[model samples]
Target: MLKLVQLYVYDLSNGLARQLSLQLTGKQIDGIWHTSVVVFGREIFYGQGISITHPGQSHHGNPLRMVDVGQTDIDEETFEEYLTEMRQHYTADKYHLLDFNCNSFTNDVVGFLTGGSIPDWIKDLPSDFLSTPFGAALRPTIDNMFRRPIPGAVSTPATIQPTPQSARAAINASPDPALASTLLQSVASQATLGPSSMAPPSQSTSTVAAPVHICTNPTSFHNTLKTHRAVVAFFTSATCGPCRMIEPLFDQLAHEKTEAAKLAGGIAFAKIDMGVGMGGMVGSEYGVRVTPTFIFFLDGIKKHEMKGANRAELTSQVNMLLFEAYPPHPHSKVTIPALEKVSTNPILFTQVPKLDIVTTKLCSFVDSASRPIPNSQTIKHTLSSEFAGYLRGQFSSNGKAVRSSATPQMLTKWTETTKTLVGHLPPSQLFPLVDMWRLAILDNVVSSWCATAAGNMTDPIQILIVKALSTLRSSEAPSTMRNYILTTLRLLSNTFSDLTLAHHVLSPSGKRSSVTSLVITTLLHEDASVRTAASSLAFNMAAAIQKVRIEQMRAMNGSVSGLDEDGEWEIELVSAVLEAIRNEVQNEDIVHRLTASLAFLLRLSPVYESQLAPLLEVLQAKETLQSKLEKGGCGEQGVQNNDIRSLIAQVAESLLVHMAWDNTRGGGIQHKTYRDCEQCTL
Candidate 1:
């Protein structure tokens, strides 16, 4: 008999998610979804891992929505066997609220029974929540909660295989708490992960072998070897008992080293089954005479071979290979407290001016223009009425609730209208319009809509910001239109609100050349306000870069080689910031922000002579920032310099104290190579 499968969806937040999701996360989330499969007269759910009870009678009560998910022909006995296999993966200790939860299990079950997936709105709760600034900030805190140990009998499940007692005892006995913490966190984090934390269970199975590459043919094996700097090939026969015994350990090692391999070029773990198609040929070519042979290949050359399935030797050899290929930085041994103290959050300019006043000022500027600018009356009305109403509904005031989010149709209309107005308005009069957009884009909904590419593959937000920046090209722009320039800089800073837009702006895809020019020019502007705005923009970009570096370093266990390959603007940004630091004798606020930007850029960068160190050396960064530490520099002549001076000194110390220039070579940092660094040795 084909049994009916229904999906029961519960709202973990009751109705509070709908009531306050927009206010908190800038998106309308109906609920924190919890789902289960109702089949065979039972409700099967995952939390403390796959539990069953009578229908509509789990700890979560009745579901808000019951989805009829077709029928399944598989009998209860076979289904139970499937559940038994699943128990190995979905143990109580492996359960995570966000990463691997009740919904993930049901999605997998639904896929198995019906060969169809659940609704995106149901499965996409984590991603949709994470898209907002508030949601992104809350993720680490949430993950940390699930990282704590489960209580009582909840800690153990029959199907779950415990980590080897030897490995656990070694890690616990280690004197270095940091090492133990790192190893423990890696295991804990991976336990709840089903492939990526974001992917659905059907798309991403719970397997430590997610990163491993299986090579069935010699062509495929050679391709894997060619691409990776390091390759570990497991030569195994289908009937070999030792190979079966050691297979799980190899998968675990692959999972552990996956992130490091990605950072340090590429490392691949390949399994070649001698009994499978063309696998015997591969083994013969590698001179593998034994069934359970393991070969380590570096740069396409066979480096070492081990005969037996010795787990300790295999683990030690792989670690040694990774260290040889991608060594840790020498600077990792040095302590830089100041750099560690720097926050990586992007600085945004979200100050909202009164919509009424801003609209009035815009109208006055257009109406009072010496010559009538194009689209003046139409844009004025659009700003004062249509856009004003939209902004009012989007932004909450005096604790009043924001209106329901704008629909796709409304957003499309606004996008078309804004694009038209931007094209028609004179470049000189574009700031007020751009300023309006600056406020609008602060609303995450509007920001997402604007960042999206239209049919022609052009982002409206990118175009609008670029147009505002182009006005700076005019010779008289700095003095004649300081408000326009400052407003544009502020808009650029706010672009960081949407990570997609911020990434494009920082990447080669974003008209980075124009932005670089704006930063270089505005940082030298005579007006302190203009310089301050530019400094904020610079800091936002630096924060984004620093954020990436920090994440990559963490993934690699604190051994990143350099900035991302796309960071072409690093040199220009460093030079421009250093030059600005030298010229700015007023505005301590600008000086402080600029120094922070410089510090973030320099910290944890490649210690090689060819990289940023040469530029910092040529520019004499230490001396330029050192001058600001003296009394009555970088601010008003009479102001007390204690606080600002102390801050500047810290930045200078963190950045410059370790830098040593080769005086004989004219202008380059003292060169350091990976091979000579003892700290990098495994």
Candidate 2:
């Protein structure tokens, strides 16, 4: 799969959400739309817009529409890591009124996830909102509110808020319990304990905050006050009417403690019931004889106190908890050299192969006297050129040609002409030329200009191969012509394993450039040899992808100074290869090639292990594939190439090994663990 994606479209103007927005703001909200990107239906990524709201709860309750947009091969953990690194970029403070708003966010996210932008109708809504008089005048209010969350809007009644986790949760979740407790203790004072325990910080404020636990009795109250970094208690009795009046506000403050913790001790809000059970003893120990009293505990000491129902005093006091817990953002305090480092390195491409024998065996050129050809002079000049003459073995039998005489410029010109020439020329004309162009990329034949060819955004081989594949797509095209085109593409693809080139070559823009789409189409081609050729192409693409993936990984390990240019195409490239293997075909040789290619990809990428559905299907449904293999047996011209069952077994083994390994962690292949599998070998 290229990218697996589901879209959540929350209509901000719908139902009570819209009514409340209007009722509170006294202006019609054109729309308060929010959307999130859900990957694999487990992890969610969406812009919350600028609001005091939890993700997906846009004051709108449930979303109006949730649609499946696309599919991806990136597993949840890797994708989530990317989102974590980019957390600050999507904050409410960075939200914009007209430009960088939620819709724009959906566009960026959807484009990255699916290679397809969100619909223009949705993206254009914010600008449309600004065109109106009311929207234009209310921009400042929206912008100001975006900079700071509105009070009392942090939690939604419709959404179930997750219970706050103590450091204990971290300790229990980790495998090394001893180290886990130690590490958990270290971050307990500062870090938000879980991905969902997110609110410890709001807007520009960065501080550590933990949940407030209600103390049931004096003993529990003592542990809470001593263990927690900050503590607050509302001393109330059955007779105090004012204490009862402010109880709900106290509860809300307890729930939303901001920047209120420093160490292993965390934030707690306890109530000492003055009239019952331990309530009387707790009140007496704290010297709280009054029916209602407030105590603030910081670091095991009484730091502040309040008496009576003073809501304003309580709010002001609670707000100061954050400044006490968090340090200012380091970026706001100091600049560092590490953050500004940039790299200077040259891009490298493979040394091209000397294709003399391979080129000669693949194609032969002769003066076709039968149907007098057009462009005979240009064709022969290209064919008989010094570089081509030696590369094609058309020179003297002494294995010599004037290759030294042709400059890189002349050879580059010949390659350029050859690419366009093959586009409209008969496929029969470009065999020797194809391999020669590939060789031109090698150090022996190429100059620095050849490297420029790739960097300058022109990949002759990719361009030529895509054009040939496109032309051969015609249903009426002769089987011989189709086979010839497929062979040329396979040969052209064999020479480059560079992902930088693959990025442009395999970009999923359209049929011509979308390498995966084209291969899938060709697998459906009638000619068995053409299908076989496409499978070979699949193998070559897999090899290229694996090599590039390993190299990129090593570069990242070494801290090599370069952006991971391959990340853009890694998903599409893998999808095209795996999906091509999964596409049904009659040729067993095709199946073998596809299986081998898939095995190669699975070996290189741990992420693809989760997407083993197609592979697993081939193994479990033996009866199903047996019929397919028999039907897809040898064509009239040849005997059965290879046993499809054997090929299926090969794919099954590749999957079983990884799935079993991954199973050790929990589950895989539809969440079925190795222990769960009756036959783990399969």
Candidate 3:
């Protein structure tokens, strides 16, 4: 597998040179250059010595720039050996202020990995500075500051010690004992930093805001309390054994409530250790004398307190606190049986085509475009080689294996390349690109990146889909637009893989206007393929809403209904879907999905009887669907047809029979007994 390589550039002077260089050195020096080679999730740089850390996590703070160097196909074992061998040439004692420094090390690594070097501007910064007369005068002062070692200066790699026995045993048992042994010695001799490379990967790849906030001082504690509408504080001390026993459970609660915790005025989790430095002062202020005390705060005031490591009580109190802060919606009081039984999983189109063929078709489209994009040959190579290799390695046919996500640097390069090609290609020729993206998004990493790319303003995937849909609606060549429409719908349906993106796309103002309009328009298209694809998109939207309601119902307990809180949008969806079903007479598959969409939209809805039930009455949904049941395709032609007929019958009964029965009773709508109603029966 090929790993992406990037050059992380940092300023050692931290912008001081930018402001004071003219006054101090009598020359304009933008920064004191510091660079690192970022690959394999580790940032490798030389400073007082060599060090490794998670990218962007060293003491230098965030990087000034992340330049794409290239990629390396070197195996992990071989790369470790290379780094071990490079250590002898770049030893700590031989380091110099101007000669062999961080930039020198990065340049060598870049050349070794990609047969290329770091940018010339960065590599020659020292020369550029020394060329000025003023810079030449400060040479002795810089040398003294770095070379005149003070007492108790931190030791370098030459003074390292041996590895532990347990660790050595584990290394010996590893598949490649020699590689593991070499890596351990290298890490021990150099300053090993961050988490262990051999540690198991985390299960979740989605980047969530830190679920818990560690507060060691009064200022931070007060700030968190004032910001969040609800706060849960777990106060403990180092010497307390019960505190250790309950810490994991406390962390579990924080992660469980992370979604609500990320809202603007949402709840927050804070941890305070009384045994630690300013932690004692903060805990004392709250009259906390015992370890493992739990406190609940609302609007920055104490509301409740518990005084033990009781797991059950902690869980219950947290739930009640959440319930108090965000009460169940008013819609939760209604009852609708048919809507309750609807499935919550969205309908996804996940058929994968041969990636090699897709790459060929895409390259052909780009090769023949009137204005070719820059780097056309390189782009084709990436599609056929690196991109294809990445997807194939990450996904398998059985689909049971768990895989890690692409690194941020890799994702950045892929998006930039794909976005350029997409912008230059015509809509009619975008089918292949859209198909590739449809498969790419099945990987959650790409889906998550596209969802948050530039806050969706310049999201490449969304732009591609919108452009294709615009063409599908207006194109005179129906034959040419068929595949485009089909792939575009599948791409939209796949957006539900990340629920955050799915909800945002279906938001009141975001993608609603364009996506809903296109799906509704295509629902009545002449081609059966277009209609099938459109129905799948419609079903996905409904299923997403249903999923949220079901989750809300579970969270709030079964006493109330689960509501999506958007009545206007639901009404529009129901109207469009009912019309589509009535007009769709030939395809049982299309009717099946459309009927399921209706069932999900009206199911467990807080306003089903009030808003949706009356809309059903106005549309005469019973007569429309009963006629569908009488259509020849809905008869006993096959097992699938019978299932479709049964679904239609259930939907009509819940929508029309319940509404008519309530109207006759002169009472507002209520959940009536479910049975065969005369107007609608399978």
Candidate 4:
């Protein structure tokens, strides 16, 4: 056992310091000798003391003691009067006599000189004597005088000798004091204190050297990017499928691209494994939640960011940005013609028929609806026939010729008629017309024209068709109309699922609900994208929910077993959906939604513990199969690391309670039935 002494000293005046030094060290000293001191303007005001009693001694060899001290300023007489008052009211012990306040002239010189039993009068002194400035100063010194050093003290000098110049270097040059203190405390049991306790160990032991790596400061990644032309950073995780997919591509670019290779220099395309180490910290700092995220930097400043895995698109964008920064050929900026010149020119403008003619005819029919012979039904019949005829004419050969010859002004007239028709009809009637245009007219009759005029359409009429269908899906539209809307959504989702077009339409930040609604509706879509997207969403959302559960578990000081048994099942379901989508990229949104749904089930269920084993087994099997395929065969090493088998065992262990109950119910059966099987060997 070792005795430890902790000293806290406060000095308020010079006289007490001299007296305390004389009494504790048996000598008059000015500076620290064997003790540590805290000076408050040169007065010994506070101190702590410790003493170790040897084995079989009266104090019983318990090797620890603690003392406290405080300092104050007061005249000797006043102090003595205070001490007398405290002695009468507080302590009347031998220790109290040792702790007292007095001036050099009036001090009990005999008590200071002789280490003997204190007088009864002195023993009755207040324990609060140390509260005075003089008493506080003497307290620590008195306490430390009884302290015993730690046992088995050994002196081991530093192995590596420092030069005189090195010794003069700043304290931080070696290692930070805080870090060194931590290292010392961690290995104190194995280490020996010496005069120069700050020095490194004398023995050239590898075990001692291992901690250095843990203590070394991490390299500053941000600082190294300053001199590079363009910094390309890849954010990835060990478990991210897209991240894994794009990693090799990035590696190829890092090796092949001349400028990129040069920029990489000795950095060697370092990877931040977001799964572990400082990588997680960096990812959090940069707000990275998804993997396969690439950040492009110019002179250490982030210029562009791409999230999700599109290797080719990422490469192209990087190349384009680099070209802009360092172009091979220079060209003058192009200027645009004045709007007035283009608008007023005869080549650009052409007169067209007015819509009033059509509007007047339609209004006249409406007015005649009150008559018995031709009422509202008759009026509607006439308008419908005329509108259909006009629309049919617009789709004929002559209509094609007129459209071909039409100028921007004439096209504008046609657009106005379409807008008027859309605005005049009720939603109930307009939905069908919109569907007809989308299905029959847009792709066949009007596609080429629309394609040519796409850039010029200030407000996209085609998007209007999508909007009308979307409205029908949400409204109390007729079942037939709703089915048509669903069909339209399915067609659109199918057409855009494999292309970047869906991403453009479904981005949460763009065109408001146009894309969001598209994605949400597609989650329920018959197409695979619906399932795929749903699964992916579900998986990501599950991770978030599980993280919350983990935090709750930690707050409650719960065991990991409870978390694994109950919380992990939902996580597994989400993970499975994500894994499925990773393999089947065609219907990602549907996959996301499916994953999210499973996650919801897990979140709402308390029987998650009961379901955990089976879920884990299934996931483990899938993972094992995937791993084996990735490795090309189930080699001995591969078989040994079969994750599914291990997970099954873990599940069995977690459900041991239920298994034990079953065993108990079966006439105290101790062995499982499988153990006696002919094919089994135990």
Displacement of the residue 420 alpha carbon in candidate 4, Å: 2.8
Candidate 3 overall lDDT versus native: 0.67
- Tens digits of lDDT, candidate 4, 228-292: 45556777776788887886677666544432222222122334556533455666766777887
What's the TM-score of each model vs. the native? 0.63, 0.36, 0.50, 0.23
Instruction: Sort the candidates on lDDT, descending order.
Output: 3, 1, 2, 4
**Cα-based lDDT for every prediction:** 0.66, 0.47, 0.67, 0.34
lDDT of 1 by residue, 129-223 (tens): 66554444444444444542333323222122343443332222222223433533443333232212222222222332445665545755776
Off by over 4 Å in 1: 1-210, 260-264, 361-382, 454-457, 566-568, 636-643, 657-682
Number of backbone-clashing residue pairs for each candidate, in the order shown: 0, 11, 2, 54
Give model 2's clash tally.
11
Per-residue lDDT value at 570 in model 2: 45
Candidates by TM-score, descending order: 1, 3, 2, 4
Report residue 641 deviation for candidate 3 (angstroms).
3.1
Pairing residues by index, what is the TM-score of model 1?
A: 0.63
Q: What is the lDDT of residue 280 in candidate 2?
A: 68
lDDT value for model 4? 0.34
Measured over all alpha carbons after superposition, the RMSD of each candidate to the real structure, in angstroms, is 14.5, 23.0, 18.4, 32.2
Top TM-score model: 1
lDDT per residue for candidate 2 within 1-682, as digits (tens), equals: 5655777776543443243322222224444555656555443433332222444543345666777767766666765654553453445334443444555445545544555555555655654444332233334433332333335455221111222243223222222334423432331111111234343333432111113343324654665565566678888876789987997788677655522221234467776666543456677887987856888877778877889888998977765543343222111211222211211121122334445554443334435333545565665556555556544333234455434433434655666566545544465555556555544443222322222233112345556656566566655446446645655545535434332234334333211244555665665566776677676766666655555544533422211111222333444544555454445444556666665565445443534334543444444433333333454433433225444455554444434332333444344433333433333332
